[model samples]
Target: MNFKRFLKWLAPVSLTAILILCTIVQGWSAPTAAQTQLHWYGQSAFKLTTPTGKVILIDPWITNPVNPNGKTDLATLNRADLILVTHGHFDHVGDAMTIAKKTNAPLVSTADLGQALVESGYPKNLVTLDTQGNFGGEISLLNNEVKVAFIPAIHSSVIASDGSPAKYAGNPGGFLVTVQNGPTIYHTGDTDVFADMALIPRFRKVTLMLACIGDRFTMGPQRAATAVGYVKPDRVIPMHFGTFPALTGTPAAFAAELKQQRVGSRLQVMKVGETIRL
Candidate 1:
């Protein structure tokens, strides 16, 4: 146990201990609590609040033909701690940039999508942004308790103009969001029930799922129910329905299918502007 040799061994060990301690302090004590509130603004838009009060908005397509009075259109409803875009559809990004400009929130999306937004009129100076592509990659926010993983989905990823081909923006995707204190939430932006749905991270363990059951464009009630059966989330919230008359699928139909398939108990049908707390 010579003095020089002992000191060399102790140095690395001490540094490792300090690093681990710092991570724990930063993740737990730095924030008084984990996220606690889950608010559904209809369709795929939702507001999540960590116990420490950090806000996260997902696929925030608040105003459209369906949600005419959506918070996105409301001037007072600006600002968020973080914003996530599942894909490049207009309904999912209508008010994202506006809210970011007003609140200076961080935008979490794919690199290609973020760049496209910047080119398509989003303010480049008003917000922070994080873009991570799908599978395994995660972004830790709100003191690291909340981790967001971009998951795969079968959907379109184009910003088309009148009579023009869809601009190849990027691949369409979904989100697998885990909140430390509450339920893990999944927002499947207009998608079909692909085999990959079963492979998405945190599948079936989700507490709430914002699913698209609008048939003409996405999966119909029967398929969505099957998607739910595969995901087996603790609860499911049907969305992307009733927005257009062509979208004949309804929550009622989803509910009936869920019951027929023994999943009705987990379905939570939210009103256009209702909030669901998990």
Candidate 2:
């Protein structure tokens, strides 16, 4: 073909190719629909992923007695935007400092406990004032993708230093986490059942309740079932049990109690290292 004819043919063809390439690139770069996910690591440790992919860890005792893969889970945790510590017990505060250092995730707890953790070697910069709150206070975080409300719990909280006496960390509490476009979750820190629990459902409808059913430390199956009746969550997952011999509150017992109480909530018993989509 002549040069002039070749140029004429190349112009439209090149334009068509550019348009097709642009379309393909745009499609590939577009954001995908986000789904919320939850992971339990036995005891009271739980990992929650918001629809926007922000990660939140509650009572992050990932390497607990019941979780055989606790070390693996901790090592593989790539992202953590916030770490919510309900109390200062060793089991509940498991690996918080290590995880905060690794992921640079800020600490969300009562003002006193946050300061105590900082004194106990958690990164001072990560446990800033903005991340701390007291009971009845709610903090909006992760660009408003999550709202964490500090709720009271019937338990004790003391922080013990290395080979030293235990000191008062703060009042014990639970977390009422509201995720944007996702389910609202209530993690009842280490506590026994209280009548005030009925007040929780008045504020927000609970999607899932992570309840402690271990008898010696927290509420047994009977009291836990009663607590569930008060909060009235759509689903209930038993935790803080089967880690030690004293924690004899089995899921079977909890299920039987739930049936006996005629609680409408569905009991979801998650195994160690299991992840579920909400």
Q: Tally clashing residue pairs in candidate 1.
A: 4
lDDT of 2 by residue, 1-278 (tens): 99999999999999999999999998786566687899999899999999878999999999997888889989999889999999998998899999999999999999999988888888999988788999999999998889999999999998886888897889999999999999999999999999999999999999999999999989999999999999999999999999999999999999999999999999999989999998
- Over 4 Å off, model 2: 1-32
TM-score of 1: 0.79
Top-scoring candidate (lDDT):
2
Residue 175's lDDT in candidate 1: 82
TM-score for each model: 0.79, 0.88
> Could you list the CA RMSD of all candidates, in the order they appear?
11.5, 6.2
How would you encode candidate 1's per-residue C-alpha lDDT over 43-64 as one tens digit per residue? Answer: 6787787666678888787775
